[model samples]
Target chain A: MSAPSSSSLSIRDLHASIGDKPILKGLTLDIPKGEVHAIMGKNGAGKSTLAKIMAGHPDYTVTSGDVLLDGESILGIEPDVRARLGLFLAFQYPMEIPGVTIANFIRAALQARLPEGEELEATDYYAKLYSKMDALSVPRNFTSRSVNEGFSGGEKKRCEILQMAMLEPSYAVLDETDSGLDIDALKIVSAGVNALRGPNIGMLVITHYQRLLDYIVPDKVHVMSEGRIIHSGDKDLALKLEAEGYDWVEKEYSAGKSAV
Target chain B: MTTETKPDIDIDRSVGDFRYEMDYAFDAGIGLNEATIDYISDVKGDPDWVREFRKEGYRKFLEKPMPTHWATKDLENIVFENIRYYLSQGQVPKRTWDEVPDDIKKTFERLGIPEQERKFLAGVEAQFDSEAAYSNIKAAVGEQGVIFVGSTEGLKEHPEIFKKWFGKVIPSGDNKFSALNSAVFSGGSFIYVPPGVKVKHPLQAYFRINAQNFGQFERTLIIADEGAELTYMEGCTAPKFETATLHSAVVELVAMKGAKIQYITVQNWSSNVFNLVTKRGIAHEDAEVKWIDCNIGSRLTMKYPGVVMKGKGARGEVVSIALAGDGQHQDTGAKMIHAADNTTSNIISKSISLGSGRSTYRGMVHVPKHLKGCKNNTECDALLINSHSRTDTYPAISVRGQGNAVQHEASVSQISAEQIFYMQQRGLSEAAAMSLAVNGFVNDLVQQFPMEYSVELKRLIDLEMEGSVG
Candidate 1:
C-alpha cells in the first residue's frame, strides 16, 4: 500500500521509557506526506527518544499507544523491516564501521529492498551511488573509504542524508542533522533535502534550535517540553520560539495543564 | 627432461585417505628412527658432521618433553609414534621446473602455485611431503647476489654459510617440535641477501601435505645481511582426513645490522591437522623484522611468532589475523622482546570466531629495565559472529625499565544487531551486514598485506561469513 498523503506518520498517546524511567510520556503527533514537519525541543525534552522509538530502536520500550505508518501498525516489525517498509531514521551520531566501504554499505541496503535472489547490478549501483554522492557534494573517492570512520561532523551528516536520499523512504526523520554543520554545509544539506521533497515522501526535522528551520523552511512547528508536545503552530511559531525561547513554552504548558 | 614421455600418475593418490588431496607421492613405511634418519642423511650424501648433528638433535628430541603448560591441553593427544616423520617420496628436489617429476608437477599445477609464482612472486618453491619438488628464482633476482633455494641444496652447495647460522636462532632444545624439526627436517626454503641488496618482489613457498598420518616438518631460514631487505611469503594446506595429521615446523630468521626482513604466511590446513609451529627472528643493531601471519583453517593451531631485538636502534613488528570457523580453535599471537636500547615494536592482532569456534590471543611484550628508549604498542581486537562463538585475550606486558614506554589496548565486541539493521536498511542482507562488520573490524591488519593477498583475504572472509548467520 502506498503511503497516506495526510498523516503518513500517526503517533497517538505514545509512552516510551528506558527501564522504569519514562522518556516520551503520552506524546502524540501527525506527519503527512508532501509536507515538512519540524519538532523543536529543549535538552531532555525526548526529541531524540521520539525519533529512536519511531525507528523501532531496541533500547527503548514503548509502554503504551501506537505508531502507524500509512495507517498500518509498525511497532511490532523489526527495525530493518520497518525501514524497508518506507520509514527512515537519520541518526545524530552515526556509528563508525571500519573496513566496510561506503559503496558496499549502501549497496547492501539497496539490495535488501530488491526481490529475493535478485542480484544488484554493479554498474547501475555505482551509477546511482555516484549520482547521490554528487548531489550531497561528497567526494567520488569516499565510496571506497570506510563508512563514517575518521569523518568530520559535516561529512557524517551528509553521509546520512545520502543514504536517506538513496533509500527514498515514504517518511524520513532527521534528528539534530544540523547540530555539527557550518553555514555552508547547512545550505548544501538543506538544498539536498529540498530537492527530494515531493508528494511521495514525508519529512520530520527534529532540532534544538530554530536556526535549521530557517534553512529548510518547515511547514509546521511543534514545541516539545517535559516529554510531550505542549504547543503546535505554523512555521512562524519556530521564529517566535527563537525570539522568546523555551522558558515561555514551559511556563505556558505547566500552568495550563495544572489548571485543567 | 622430456616432457611428453612421463606417465600420468594420479597425484591425488599421494594425498592418501584424506578428504583434502595432497599433491605429492608417499614412501612406503617411512618412520622416525636412527635408521630412517641415517637413510635420509645417506640419501642426500651428507658430510659426516651433518649426520652427527642430526644424531645429536635426535637424542635431544628424545630427551625433551612436549610443551604442556602454555597452550591447549589437547595438544597432548598428538601421538608422536603414530606420525610418519620421514618421507622423501623418492623424488629429489630440482632447481629447474623441467626436472620435477610429472606427478609432482601436476600437484603444483592443481594447487595453483606455478601461476601464482608467475604473476607476482619473485621466486617459488613447491614442497610435497618432506621434500621440495621444484624450486625456481627469477634470473634478475639471482643475478643480484640473492640466493633462494631448498635448505637441503643450501647445505650441499653452501655448507660454510648454511652451517654457521643453522640452529643458532632456534636451537634443537628450544622446544619439542623444534627439536623434532632439527632432527628430521627435510625440505624448506633457505634465503640469503647480501649486504646492500634489496629484493623488490616477494619470494613464496607452498607446502602441500600428500600423505595421511604423515608429519611435514619444513625448516625455513632467511638471513638478510647488513643493509639488505627482503620479503618472503609461505602458504600451507593439507587434504582433509578422518584421522588427524601432525605438522610441526621451525622457522628462524636473522636480520643483521641495517637489514630488514618481512615474513608472511597464510595457512589453511584441514580441520584434522594439529598445527604446532615455532617461528622466531633476531634483529641486530639498527635491523628490522616483521611477521604478517594469517590463520584461516585448522582443528587447533598453536603458533606465536616472536622477535628478539638484540641491538640498539632495532625494531620489530607483527600483524596477525585469524578466522576460526566450526570445530576450530585458533590460538595465535606474537611475542616481542626488547633486549637493547632504542628498540621499538608494534603488534596489531585481529580475530573472528564463527559457530562453535574459539579464537584466543596470548601475547607477551617485554622490555627489560636496562633497555633505554624502548617503546611498545600492542592492540588486540576480536569479533564474535554468533552466540556460541568465543574470544579471549591474555596479554602479558612486562616493562622492567623506567625508560621504556608501553601501551596495550584490547577490545572484545559482538556483531551488534543495531549495526546490522543499519547496514540492512541500506539494502544489504543480514549475512552481508555481518560480513561488512567483520571486514571493518580487521581492515587495518588486512591492509598490511600486499594488494593481491589483501583482495584474496576479503574474498576468504566473505566465504567464511556464509553459513555463519542464525
Candidate 2:
C-alpha cells in the first residue's frame, strides 16, 4: 500500500525490527498539525522503538512500513535530512558531546537551515537564545558549557526543550522528557512546552507515567499494547489508566487479538 | 602569523595553491657538498668564522644517519642529490613591496601577507624562497629599538648581537634536520628586542616555498634581552603555493633574566611537504618562554619543540594542536629539561586524526637529581573521527630531584556513533558534524592563535571533512 495523503506525521501499518527481534508490528498513528497527543504503555510496549524508527535511526530496519511527513514519504533519508524536513525527536537519553557548547550546537543546527553564503546574525541569535533560555529557567551561563556534559537530569531535559524551541520544528516527539525531572522541573518544563504549542506545530509526548500527562494535558490519549494502539480516548483515559493500571486494557486487547 | 583585519576566505583558501615562474639570480646546483657550501657562503658574503660554521654543519649532516629507527621510514625518501640547497634572487631584502622583484612580490601578494600585517601584526618579515621579498615594521616598535629582519640581513647587520646567541639554544648538531638547516638555512626571521624594551604587538613571519624541488631550510633566531618581552609568530596559517618536498627548519629562542618570549606557529603546508623541524629555547633566571604550535595538512611531520630551564625560578610552556587527514601522519610533542632549581614547566598537546590518518604524541621531561622544588605537568589528548584513524602516545618522564613534583594525563577517544547521530538529529550533516567535533577538540589551542585564525581553521576543517566524505 502507498503512504497516507494527509497533512500529518502518518505512520501506516508499520512493522519494524532490530536485528532478529521484531518490536513494532502493524502500528498505525497520525498526528496532524496544531494538536498534542500522548501515548501511554508499560515496559517493552515498543513506544521508544517507534520514536526511533520514525527518526530513521540505523539500529532498526523497517520490514514493511511507511512514515510520512506532511504527505511525503521520509522512509530512507538520513537522520539529519529527516530533521531538516521538520521531524524532531527529544531523545530519551540525550548524548553528551564534550567540548561542544550549547550556543554553538544550536547555531550549527540553525545555520544548516540557512541558504549557502548566508550568515547567522550573532547579536540577534544570542538575544533570541537568551530569551528562550530565560523562559525555560535555564541559567544564561549554561550556553557556554558542553552540551549535556555534567548536566543534571533536569538540565538535560531543559536542554532538549531549549533545542526544540530554537529549531522550532514542525513536528516534535518528546520521549519521556519528565522521566528524571522532579515536580518543580516538570512544572518548568511543561510551561516551556506549552509556550511553544500553537497552530503551527504537532507534538507527540510519549511517557510511561500518566503524571506527565496531567501537566502537559494532551488533547488525545492512546493506550499502546503489543506494539500497536489498542484504544484511544480523551484526557480521562489517562486518569483511568493511571488509577486502574493497564491490566484492563491488556485483558481487553488480548481478547480482541485472540478472537480475531 | 599573518592576520587580516577582515580575512578573505576565498583568497585564504587559495593562498598556497598558485605558484609563479621566476628568473633566478642564483641557484646552488642540486646536491650537498663542499662546493655547495662554498657557493652559498660566497653568495652571502659570509665572514671566515661564519664560513667555518657552515662547514662544521655540513660535516655533521654527512655523518648523521636518518632517524628512521624512532621516526617514519619515509625519511629515507628525501633525495638529497635531487634537492637544490639554495635558490634566490638576491640577499638584500626590499623594505617596500614595490621595490621587490615582480615575481617574488606576486608570490607574497598571493600569500596575502601585507593584508595580514595591516592591523594585528606589529611587524612582518615576508620570506619568499631563499630570501626576504618584503619587510616592514611599525615606527613605534622601531623607535623602541626592536630589531626585526630576515636572517640574511640580521647576520650581516647585527652580528655582535646575533652571533652571541646563534646556535646557542639549539646547536647545529642537535639533530639531523637541525644540522641540515644550519648548513643550508636561508629565508627565516631574526629578531632581538633591546634590554627592557617590550614590543607591544606580535611580530609575524610569513613563509612560502614557491620553487619546486627546492628544499627550504629556514633558520630562525629570536632573542629577548634582559627584562624584555616579545611575541614572535611564525609559519603563517596558510597552505604554500607549491609544496617543497623537504622542509627542515631550526629555531632557537633565548629569554634572558626577567624576560619573556612567546613563539606561535600555525603550519598548514601542502600534503606533498615533509616537515621535520627542531625548535628549542633557553630561559634564564626568572625568565619565561612559551611555544604555541598548531600543525595541520602535511604528508608526514615529525617535530618536538623543547625548552631548557637554565637558571633558577624559570618557567616553560608548550601548548600545541595537530590535525591529520587522510594519508597524513602528525608525530609531534614537547620536551622539558630542567637544569636549575625551583623551575616550573607545563605541556598541553591535543591531536585529531581523520580517515586513515595517524597521530602520535611523543614527549620527554627530565629533572636532574640535584635540582629542588621543580614542578611539571603534561597532558595529551587524541580524538579520532573514523574507525581506521589511529593514535599513539609515548611519554618518558624522569624526576629524581628532591622535592620535585611531576604529573601526566592522557586520553584517547573517537567520535562515538551516538554522538554523531545526536548531532545529525539536530540537522547537521554527517560531514559537518564530524568537522565540528574535530574543531571542538582543538578549540582551546586554536584560541591561542591571533586574530581570526580560529575562524579560518573552522572553515578549513569543514572543507576537509566534506572532501573526506566525498
Candidate 3:
C-alpha cells in the first residue's frame, strides 16, 4: 500500500488498547487537508478508540504504531501537547467543566497555544470568539454559560463545533458529532464545520450512520471492521454502506482475512 | 512618651529568625492584668466608658475557661498567662501616616500593606502587634458616609451606635476565644454603611504580628444598615517562631432589612501560629449575608463563620475554601440557623490537602419545627493532592418542619496522574498543569470572590504549586 499524498494526519499500523483488551489492531488511515474524511463502523470497531488514541488520551495505551501530526510522530506527546500541536478531538461526550465559561475555556485553550510571555489581547480574543459563535448560530449569551453544563444534546454538539472552530486545529476528529443532534442542529453544526474548511485545516468526521454524510458530504469514506479499515472508496461508499448495512462488510472482511 | 533613639538593633536579633517578624520598638510584657489593660486603655486616651468596658471584659475573660472540647484541641494547651496580651510602640495611633513613628511605619512598610493598598485596595488599616499603627480610608468612600476605622476609635466617636451592637451579636463570653478577644482585643476594623448607601469597593485590613509569644486578639464588627451594602476584606500574616504565638479573633456582622454584607478573609499565618477565630452574622428581613473565607496557613485553625436568619425572607450563604499545606490542620466550616419563616441558607465548601495536611469540614444547618418554607443546601468537596493528605466532612443537618427542604452532598477526590499527564502533554509544565487542574477544581467557588481577591487567590495557588513536584 502506498502512502496517501497531501495527508496532514497519517495513522499507520495503529494498535491501541486499554489494559489487556486490544481495541484497535493495525488500523491505518490518512486525512488530507481541505477535505472531510468519514470513518463508518459498528460499536467497538475501533472508531472511538482511534479518535482517543489520536488525541493522546491517557486511558488508552498505544501498543505499537505511529500517529503523525503534520508528518511528525505524536505518539509520546501529552494530550494537551497534542492539542497545542494542532490536533483537536471533539469528544462524543463532552466533559462538563463547572464554573468555567465556554468563552473562558476556549480562551484558555487559545492562550495555551500562544508563546510564553506574549499575552492574549482581550479585545481581539473576544472579537474572534463572538464571530465564531455567530457563525455557529450560538447565542451571544452562551459565552458566559458553563462549558457543556446543563446543555441539551444538540447544544453540546454545537459547543463542540464552536470549540473546533475557535481552536482552528490543523487536524480535527469529530467523534460522533452527529450522534445526539437533531436535524436542524446537525445542519447548523455541519454548516459551521463546512465554513471552517480550508487549505490549512483537515477534518475526520466519525459517525455510525451515513445520514450525516448527506449534510457533511465527505470527500472520502473508509469502512472500518474488526479494528481496521477493510474498504476505502469515495463518498458513494458511505451511501452503499448506509443501504447495505455493516454486517455484509464485516462478513466479507473476516472471510478475506481467514482465507489469507 | 518621647521617641527614644536607641542603638541600631541587629536585624537577625531583632527579627529573631522569623520570616514574618518585624523590627518594631515596643515595651514588651507577658500576661493580661489590670495594669496592662489600663496601660493599653490609657495609651489610647480612651474615654471612661471604654475603660469600663475593658475592665468588664477583663472580668469576663477571667471567668471564661479555655475551650477544651470543640475543634482545635491545641488551644487547650495555649498558656494564656505566659502570652503577652498587648504590645504597642506608640502611645496613640497616628491620625495620618506621616505622624506615625518611623519604626511603626517601617514595620507596615515591610509588610507591603501600603503598597498593596495603593495599588488595588480602596482603603487600608495596618495593625502592628496590638494596635492599628496606620489607618486610612479613601476620601471618596468616606464622603459616602462609609465608616472605616479601628474598633477603639469607633468606641470613642460613635459610642451610642458602637456600644449598642458591639458585643450584642458575639457576646463577651460566646466562647473562650471570644472572651479572650473581648478582654485583650486592641486593633480591628469597625465598618458601618449608612442606610441605603452602597460601598462599591472593598475595605481591607492587614494584621501583622511582630512580637514573639504574644497573642494578638482583634475584634471586628461590620453593620450594613437597612438597604445598605458593603464588602470587607481582611488578611493576616505572622512571622515564624519556634515558640508559637496565639491569635484569637472575633468578627460580627449585621445585615439589616434589604441590606447585603459580604465579608472576606484570607488568613496566611505562619505554621507556628494558633489561629482560633469565631465569626458570625445576623441577617434581618429581606437581607443577605455572605462569608467568603479562605484559610491558607496556620498550624491549627478553628474558625467557623456562621449566620442566623432571624427575619422572614432573609438569605444567608457561606462559601469557604481551605487549603492545608504541610504541618497544618484546618478545622473550618459554617453554621446556618433558620429562625424565621421562609428563610434560606446555602453553604458550599472546598478544601485541598497536600503533604500530610489535614482538612475537616464540621458544618451544621438547623431549621426548627416552627419555621415553614425554610430551605437549605450544603455541599462539600475535598481534593487530596497527594497520598499522605487527609480530608473529612461532617455535616449535621436537622429539619423538623414539614414544609422545609434540605440537601447535602459531599465528595472526596484525588488528583489523577492521568489528568496531570494529559495537561503536561499540552505543553504545560507539571507544576503549571497541576495548578490549573487544582484551580479548576475550585473554580466554582473562586469565581464567586471579588475580582482582586480571585487574582490573589490564583497567585496563592501558584505559590503553593512551586516545588510541589517530587
Instruction: Compare the candidates by TM-score and give the number of the best one.
Output: 2
lDDT of each: 0.84, 0.86, 0.82
CAPRI-style quality class for the chain A–B interface of candidate 2: medium
Candidate 1 regions with alpha-carbon error over 4 angstroms: A1-87, A99-104, A107-146, A149-155, A166-171, A176-188, A204-214, A218-260, B1-32, B42-47, B94-107, B368-371, B386-389, B399-402
Q: By the DockQ metric, which is better: model 2 or model 3?
A: 2
In candidate 3, list every pair of residues with a backbone clash: A78-B425, A80-B426, A81-B425, A81-B426, B20-B239
Worst ten in a row by lDDT for model 3 chain B: B1-10
Q: Write the per-residue lDDT of candidate 3 for residues B1-470, one digit (tens) a residue.
A: 00011212111112212453345445447877888878777677788866777787788888877666555566666787789887776645565778877766776776567777777766888888888877888888899888889998888888877887888888887877787787667889898899999887788998888778988989898999999998888888777777889999989899999999999988888777899998999999999999999998777898888999999999999999998776678889999989999999999999988776789999999999988999999999999988777788889888996999999999998767755654443345567767776787789888888887788788787677664663
| Per-model C-alpha RMSD | 7.7, 4.3, 6.9
Candidates' TM-scores?
A: 0.80, 0.96, 0.83
**Which runs of model 2 end up more than 4 angstroms from their true locations?**
A1-5, B1-15, B236-244
Per-model i-RMS = 2.4, 0.8, 3.6
Cα lDDT tens digits, model 3, A1-260, are 55645457988898888999988989888888888899998887889878888887778989998888767888987677788888888878876655567887677677788888988899999999999989888999999987777999999989988888888888999899998888999899889988988888889999999989999899999988778999888999998888889888878888988999
| Decreasing TM-score order of the candidates | 2, 3, 1
